[model samples]
Target: MFRTWMRFFTPGAVHHRLGLVCLGVGLQHGAVPAVGPRVLDGYVAVVISSGRGWYRTPDGRRTAVTAPALVWLTPGVPHHYGPDPDTGWDEGFVTFTGPDTATYTELGYIEPERPVVPLADASGPRDVIARIARAARQGNPLLEVETGAAVHELLVALRRARADLAPDGDPVLHALARDACTGMTVADHAARHGMTPAELRAAVRRVAGCSPKDYLIGIRLGRAQELLATTELSVAAVARRVGYDDPAYFSRLFTRRVGAAPVRFRAQQSRAVPDDWNEGLQEDAEPGPPVAEPVDGP
Candidate 1:
């Protein structure tokens, strides 16, 4: 939910619909609308937040998307889509044009000759739309840049998620998952796999492409991302929520792992202020833990 929100709000900086524009189509909770086989005036991205749907492209190829999935469509591409009548559907989308579209084209994230790869990642699709939606409502000055960043994030997330789902199923992956999920110490993780830490590190490196610690950090950061983008919690609150009790330590770790401080990072990813914050919710008067200073700059 946080990921989705971040993606939706990330594009909020875009307002004038510049020569090339990116605008949300809408967000529907209960059911997806039956949309066209005709061309949209601009590019389109269709993401299923929940339920299921089928999309048909100009060339007659068909694809199915369920809860947490995305189907990108290029402008001038004739397409038709609708929810599965029996199951119903909920969906969100963004329409964008401008310099970034060219970037997507160059990267082959989008294809001018065709709709290209209808990239599908349940999380990627959800997060991208959520970020865009957030930016839309916030109406920030940096919207386009944030939305562009969100686009890049989606592509990277899709690539990593695809690799994880590969059919080979390397034995070392089990150790990786365990460390990433349990927050176990290096020695403990090795013991769980019945190996010395040195040997465990070698095995993980050979198969997973990063050190075990780095891998675990990535997993934790991904979770932290989800929390920060969706919840109304303060930076310190979100830090604790994601397993780092020491907010200062978490900020440093987050910067090392995610490339930015949590507050600005979340701000860049999506502009939506939390609901309570928007409603002018005040902090409780009771004294609390020492307030650690957040790091400045990216």
Candidate 2:
């Protein structure tokens, strides 16, 4: 029998205000039977630590596997994949759910309606698999936090493995874009980073093909869409938190950028799109912009 839980690290449990499924890992062995394709309930990722097999999907498809590879299965996508009966496979797998996981779908990480990404190298996934298995078996309170961190690490490794797969976009530019979208002006961010606005704009354009301000707006709009979908905040409240003071202006900007009013955007998002993100929803109640706390309280 395949073990769903294994013993490893003892990270404490995590509490998510918004919904996020638990993180867990397992290893299993099975011979692929000629059965109907299995559709994933959510996001399922498999790292073939060692195996030889072939997987197929409808529309006449096949993935020949030997050595280590990753397979990602997104929710509701139908596909048939399993080990060859001749050489039954050994596999390590994990499952997780949250807004970020949903975002991966948008980014095409779990697409092709094909939910698997076979890693070219096994070492990274192997180590992470061990850690997660141990943590699950131990059942530590901090498992959520630890498991989340481990998932992030695994994603980073996967990004490295698939770096050539993404467009040439600077990570710094992406950070700046996010900062700008959250209401930081290009001039303000440039000043903070010891660069003039023109210099910052030039750098951003070179990599992201957009001016700093435009990129920022894109980032902010994306965040607003997330909030509108997941929270009960009024349009004005969402605007204010995202750095817009006038709710009317925010609605106009949302319509111009996102092609819909805030209310409509929220409706569309909830109806079909599932957002697992919960980050910016709490900002409205956070008193003010985040600041470093005093090292030692008076």
* Candidate 2 lDDT score relative to the true structure: 0.63
Q: lDDT for each of the candidates?
A: 0.60, 0.63
Candidate 1 residue lDDT tens string, 21-47: 454435665544567877865676665
Model 2 alpha-carbon drift over 4 Å, by segment: 1-20, 29-36, 112-118, 163-298
- Candidate 1's C-alpha runs over 4 A off are 1-21, 59-62, 111-121, 162-298
What are the per-residue Cα lDDT tens digits for candidate 2 across 1-298? 2223333332233344233444567777656344248775656667777767777766658878665677776677676777778777778777766667755544444444544455556777668867777767444776777676677566555544442333354666756755643546667777767877777776665444557767767776787787788777778777766767667877998899888889888887854333455544654554344322111111
Cα TM-score per model: 0.43, 0.48
Model 1, position 269: C-alpha lDDT score: 78
